[model samples]
Target: MHPKKVQKLIYFVFCCLFTLPVLAQNRVVTGRVTDAKDNSPLIGVSVVAAGSATGTATDVSGNYRITVPASATSVVFTYIGYTRKQVTITGTTLNVTMDAAGTALNEVLVVGYGTVRKKDATGAVQKVNAADFVQGVTTNPLQQLQGKASGVTIATTSGDPNSSPTVRIRGTVSLSGNSDPLYVIDGVVGADIRSVSPNDIASFDVLKDASASAIYGSRAAGGVILVTTKTGKAGTPQITFDAYTAAESPLHLLDFADRTQYLQAYQQFYGKPMPAGTSTTSDQGANTNWFKLITHTGISHNESMGISGGNEKGHYRGSATITISKEMCAHLS
Candidate 1:
């Protein structure tokens, strides 16, 4: 070969020898971790290379960077409240979304004055969790529990916005006034359910029969309703907002006489047409609709915003909400 060609071939051979060693070494791995429900990043999640000591934790934004040997087959990602995830090392970057583990079977319920595990409680107590309750435009917390609990009956005496519903447990107790069950909120005995908003409640527990009511003695005669509010989870501070707007009208409107019918009725009763100019309003012309005049679409809204956070030791949550509704009157229009 020519001298220049020989030199060029020698240089190429040297470069290949140097790169071969690097290619056999460990590979760099990167990924991100997020929540499956909200897609929020999970920080400080443990990421470990399978069958190797190589490992790293995610940053505040759930991004992780690590290096693993060529022998590594997969990487494992884990968080406290989420299920573990394993991804094969097929590419340079992997993104994982983890779902919350099933923990409802281990949930704790607040009874009369104490608390007990849900599985251990033998009472007829039926629990309606935050997810099961009706969420929108509910002022009196009892409204959230309507028809959800067995043997519980909810009745509203009127459509007044400020009035709370009468929640009866196990029918009439003594044929007396307001046989509604007693409400206990956060351990406050005989609490008013109206004071708490459905949007703020975390759980609604109803204690029925003697087994469940034995905790409170005579006060439990009418049964009991226990309410628990939301609290922060162990993690970084997070802000959340939820809102709902609803409009409601009567299911059926009343059928009434129009102007012609009113005049006819007057003629039938008094043998005379409707007196001219007796009423200056449209009703005199029979064009006025009595039902429509008094009835309007009832509008209601529920809005809430909160911030919560904590570490392993303790956690707290604070929130504010607004609810608007008007009394539903008879729709004469």
Candidate 2:
């Protein structure tokens, strides 16, 4: 053969020798990954061949296929909020069940000046997520947090929707009857909770003991309520709309003396038939239903719109809310 032809033939033989072993050593492994607690398939799980970069991710159905080299003895599976697992390769098919990682204990709490894991925190703290908030037409955000946290009492002075609910932590802590907990919004001390719409709230971290005093001073004597509003998330821009309407009316009315009953009572007290034409400001001779005349069905509505989105570097969110409420008491025209 010619010198150039001989060189080309040798190069082709070397390429085959190097590629054949790699192709033969690689094997395809397939399996499904699921949650151990509920046995639900877990999507987006990362599956990597042990000791090699060869890896793949579980699809929407939680099924995965990876090319494992002969040098790899196992495969690693990892996902957020789940325990990492590794399985020895015994055959072409491998199934894995992943247990949930520490949920409550592993929660990252937003405390004063920093974050602390719930398991490490020594103070009496409770967290209420947005998903757990009360649903209804609410004029105040605190109303949404009612009955969600322990050691917290939330009540309104009346049934009027305009009135803000009073929040007390561990009952009345003051002689002045002002048991409002200190409001901390996004690291701003004494921020007004009303400024943030209920639909914009992300979560509430309530510090319900004397330990809170160390952070916000005596103002937190009743307790400390840390409010974290929703912010933009890393994803496509999202627009959300929330609205609710409530109708209010008195369930029962007090039974009072009507014209006939009042006349009979008067006659009984006087021990004779009352004189006729005894028309006075009190005796208008009209059996008017004062309860019906003074009250009517009231309506309350709340509507909110928000938009949020961002990338890994930063995010932004903005929202607006409109609320209209009317009391049951009818106005005499």
Candidate of highest lDDT? 2
lDDT of 1 by residue, 1-333 (tens): 999999999999999999998897888888889999999999999999998888999999999999988888899988887788888988989998989887653677666657788889877778889888865566677788888888999887777667888777988896765576777888888887777656668888888877887878877888988888878889789898988888888888988887767778888999965676565455534576667767777888778888998999998888887877764555443
Cα lDDT tens digits for candidate 2, 230-319: 899999999999888889889999888887788789899888676476654565645888888898999888889999999989999999
RMSD of model 1 against the true structure: 16.5
Candidate 1 Cα outliers beyond 4 Å, as residue runs: 1-110, 113-122, 262-287, 326-333
In the order shown, what is each candidate's alpha-carbon RMSD? 16.5, 13.3
* Residue-pair clashes, model 1: 6
Query: Candidate 2, clashing residue pairs?
Result: none
**Looking at model 1, which ten-residue stretch has the lowest summed lDDT?**
277-286
lDDT by candidate, in order shown: 0.81, 0.87
